[model samples]
Target: MKGAALDTPHIAFVGAGNMASSIIGGLIASGHSATCITAADPFPASLERLRKSAPVAVYNDNAEAARSADIVILAVKPQIMAEATDSIAAVVRSNNAVVISIAAGVTIASMQARLGPEAAIVRCMPNTPALLQHGASGLFGNDNCSAQQRDFAQRVLSAVGITCWVDSEQELDAITALSGSGPAYFFLFIEAMIDAGQALGLNADIATKLALQTSLGASQMALQSDVDLAELRRRVTSPGGTTECAVQSFEQSGLRKIVATAMHAAADRAAEMAREMG
Candidate 1:
């Protein structure tokens, strides 16, 4: 990718939490100058840590961070979004900068209502894998956002990982379930696999290492291979083999049904949070 398209844009992070740190790391890794970005957090320790890694400026006030930024990112917790936005709303609205929010359960409309009708809002949901630059982000732009604004948002988000754009804001809740909360499900599976391996006589350390690597290799293959997962699995599971034994156990345990149920519950909870926020 050409560096010109990603030149510093006077970006500001309203909350320098984990997600914000991931994005900041991605931006710097993607050729953006640390001097172009600024972050704000109330905690002195967080600010000190951010300052050590990047040449970016740090502020204790959200409004100070947003004052001159071309793109302002709100990375605070959803429950505190109102308070955070309220602190910087005046400056952000006055600047008319494009605002990208990673706060789960906060809608673009809610941000717009707080920032102003003219605010160009993009709502994003990125999972925890973002910390490793393997994130899956779902982006939805409000009507007021221009194509350039959307592209800019996509560029910034793509720095962290893969990005998908959604047409309807409502789909963000589903994205939250599939991508935002998806890592935990996979981690849970890995934990169970390691435990089962240990129960089968492997040492704890060996079981953990084997389970993690297996999961990684399988996921990489599933992503890179053109063949379907079912086909791949079928090729591996020879008749009456150990793999088949495990497959049968999983089938008998209703693993697929359990996963579906869990994902549905996550989606339902996201929807409930959205409704409650209103």
Candidate 2:
């Protein structure tokens, strides 16, 4: 990417939380100008941490930060998203900035109502892993968003990790279930594995180290291999071996069904949140 194209746009972050800071770091690493980035947060400590890594301006007023920005990222929590967006809605629209929101369950319709119909908006779900620059995000843009606006949104989120776009706003709920809340499921499974290892007489530290390394190695292998995940798993499970016995136990216990039920519950709750937030 040309440095001029990346650095020319002025970006504003409405919240300076960890995820927001991660994005700022990424944009800078991507050759964006730190002077062109501004972040707003109520807490001085958050701003302090943000400035420790980037030389961006910090503001206590959301409107001030967003007024001249070419792109405005809404990184505030869902509970306070309305208040945050309402504070800068007029300025953001006046600036003709592309508003990219990472707050989950806050619908585009809800934002449009506050920011006016002409506001270009993108709604995205990015997980906490963004802080480590390993996040995955799902984005859905309103009709008012131009192709340029969509590209800008993609560039911003892709700074942290991978990004996928969904056809409809409703599909974002499914994405929220699959990738947005998926990390917690993996962590839970890792915890169970560690406990099982400990029960089998491995020390806690050793078990945790082994589980973490195995998770990392398996993920890297999957990413680097051409084979499908099921094939990869099958390759490790010899017939009538210990791995096969464990796989059989998991299958008999309806693990797939349980996982599906949990994911569906997450999607349902995401939909519920949209209604409640609306």
Candidate 3:
């Protein structure tokens, strides 16, 4: 192939915050050339911090960074997503760049309104754990996107963590319910565990550390185990034992129903946000 490296799609980041930094760090670590990336941020301090972390070109003007790029990543907060995308719309349309957005609550239609109807956009939902390179991302591309564009979008997100593609944009809301808001659910459980541990006589510090570590260990165990989660739980809860007692209490208390209700609320809210934004 002629100029294989030269053909690598140039990518521009519309915001240089924590998520952007994590994705950039992962891309560089995975051998994607830093030279092919550019980032724009209003704050000079944020730009400087990004530069310190990754040696990519930084710009104060979104258009300047995005101009003629093959891909543009929207990494700003949802509240500012429209303004950030508007600033780069002309540049993106001129180059026919594939737009990959990582912001929650912004839909493909809203983006197309800003970037023009023919704009190729891939909407994504990624959780906070992405900062630690242990995140899950769900992506959905609009009709304007080519197969290659979708693949490229997946590759960019896969740099940070695991990614799965959904058939419809609406399913992104389910993703929001699960992987998107899933971390907070786990954290809440840990908090409850910590408080209960303290009530049971462990010191505050000891309770906190033990709860956090146990959460981590359990997650790792589930991830590494070949058996299904229900089977794993059965193994942990021996017949007529303390674990069984706790498990029985949880089931009797309708814990599963509580979790189902919470996830449904999250999905509904996600859909509501998309509608409001749309």
- Predicted structure with the largest TM-score when compared to the true one: 2
TM-score, candidate 3, is 0.95
| CA lDDT, candidate 2, residue 138 | 95
lDDT by residue (1-278, candidate 2, tens digit) is 11225436889999999999999998889887898899999999999999998999999999999877889999999999889889988887677888899998899999898898888899999988888889899999999887877888898989999999999999999999999999999999999999999999999999999999999999999999999999999999999999999999999999999999999999999999999999
List lDDT for all candidates, in order: 0.87, 0.91, 0.90
TM-score, each model? 0.94, 0.96, 0.95
| Ranking 2 against 3 by TM-score, winner | 2
> What residue runs in model 3 are displaced by over 4 Å at the alpha carbon?
1-7
Q: For residue 212, what is the lDDT in candidate 2?
A: 94
Lowest lDDT 10-mer window, candidate 3? 1-10
Please identify model 2 stretches exceeding 4 Å from their true place. 1-7
Writing each residue's lDDT as its tens digit, candidate 3 over 1-278 gives 11213446788999999999999998888889999999999999999999999999999999999975789999998899889989999887788889999888898888898999989999999988989888899999999988778878888888889999999989999999999999999999999999999899999999999999999999899999999999999988889999999999999999999999999999999999988877
Candidate 2, run of 10 with poorest lDDT? 1-10
